[model samples]
Target: IKDFLIKNKITFIEDETNNNEKFTRNRIRKNIIPVLNASIAGGLGKFKRFFENTDSVLMLFDFLIEDRLNIMKSKNPIILDISKILYYNNKLRKNLLYYILSKNLFVDSSLIESIDRVISSKRPNIIFKEKGMIIEKSYNDLKIEREAGDEFDKEDFLKPGMETLFNGYTLKITKTVFIESLLKKKNVFVFPLSAGRRFKIRTLQTSDSFVPFGMNKEKKVSRFLMDNKISLSERRRVPLILNEKDEILAVGSLRRTGLYRMKKQKGCLCIYVGKN
Candidate 1:
């Protein structure tokens, strides 16, 4: 390209700043690239060759993202299953994390450590607090959000077949054909038959007691969350899903109130959880 330009007498301007070593890119090019070029065979060519294959890599990346988006049953916060992300290697995890926080002014690499810790642990709602940023695992979905100017206090009504976003989660309540296998407290449950017809999603309540499936016992919501490693600050913000009769069905992605056990069922209610 430069030879063609010179032969055609095409005038071009050089960026003066490109020559200044004060900039990191210029410093690296002048100091590091020359050393690599001299010490290693095909050092310069290797860099160029990698980029030549970038198109194919980028296409694969796009396909993975598209596939995840397609399987999403609900939106708004666009929650994704944690297992789907953790399934990838570290490099892929970093890329996915960057993609998740792409909307922020800048994505900090330090977040990777906190994110990895949260994903691996049995804990829930452990916030990775940064400047104007709050990242936490809501159930299986990695949730990210900017610190709000005001308190996050809001409520919404959830009906079967409808999905909505609440307190940094994309809540999806879907009714599907239920098949009872005698397994208890599964994420997918029978609606109306299991969770009832309507749900009211709001902030956590002091009186809440969530029953673990088939255990037939009630535990304090705060204690349950604390035992799950939910921080005091996050526990207050955690939303609770209440049935029409004001019974706790779920403590907002942390756990479901699994009181009723199904022996045989016709349909199921699926609550797909994810981060915004």
Candidate 2:
């Protein structure tokens, strides 16, 4: 390449660091590799061929892994169906695990091994946390979640406007005349304005209980969440809307109090939970 460049009058600047013996690459090229080439039969050529073959195998492995991942497609938490990969050989399984986890965490061989063990165990619910990331196995689904930036209890006053809450959710509190419009939306909850605009948003509590929108009997907030299939990590981030007396008016985007549901046309407050 250098001879061809010189013959063609193609000017190029060389990095002097390439020749510096203090660097590991330079030391290997200057000292160790020449000795190996002289003592062994086609040592450098054999090493080059080994790497080329390894690269080709890896390319094929990547293609196969990508096809499998597309079939197991899921949302934000990167859920994988255990059944899909349960029958795979060890090498392919580990490769797929590394691919899925490498996006958010530094996936080493040991980490991959640990994940493999979890899969083999077949525990209904198993959680492994490392470096601010959580990998949870629940029945057939393996979920990967990043720990929230601020996992502490997030609370705010629900005023008559828009505000941000836990996990970048938009909490919009406004008075709307069209009761039918707000009724159609799942995240939007309506309450009588005469009930007084004194709602506040806070994290869940163990003893929290509320009468769900359609139910006459009161239910435990924790039980409600479990029934609704809310994960343990997600329960912490769910905002509980309350009045001045600390009565639970709503449980995040899940449920609201039936005691407060109003059908009045004129004056009603709309509390909308929206994603950014």
Using all chains and alpha carbons, the TM-scores for the candidates as numbered come to 0.42, 0.44
Q: Please count the clashing residue pairs in each candidate, in the order shown.
A: 5, 0
Worst 10 residues of 1 by lDDT: 67-76
- lDDT accuracy of residue 223 in candidate 1: 87
Q: Model 1, residue 180: displacement in angstroms? A: 6.1
lDDT of 1 by residue, 1-276 (tens): 668889999998778999976565785567546755654356667756544765444543444454432322223344556766665556756667665444222345776666666777787657667755576677777666655645675566666555565667777676655655423434433443665777787877778787854557888888888889999888877778778888887776666666654445675666655556
Q: Cα deviation in Å at residue 189, candidate 2?
A: 0.7
TM-score of predicted model 2? 0.44
Name the lDDT value of residue 192 in candidate 1: 39
User: In candidate 1, residue 8 scores what lDDT?
Assistant: 100
Off by over 4 Å in 2: 1-150
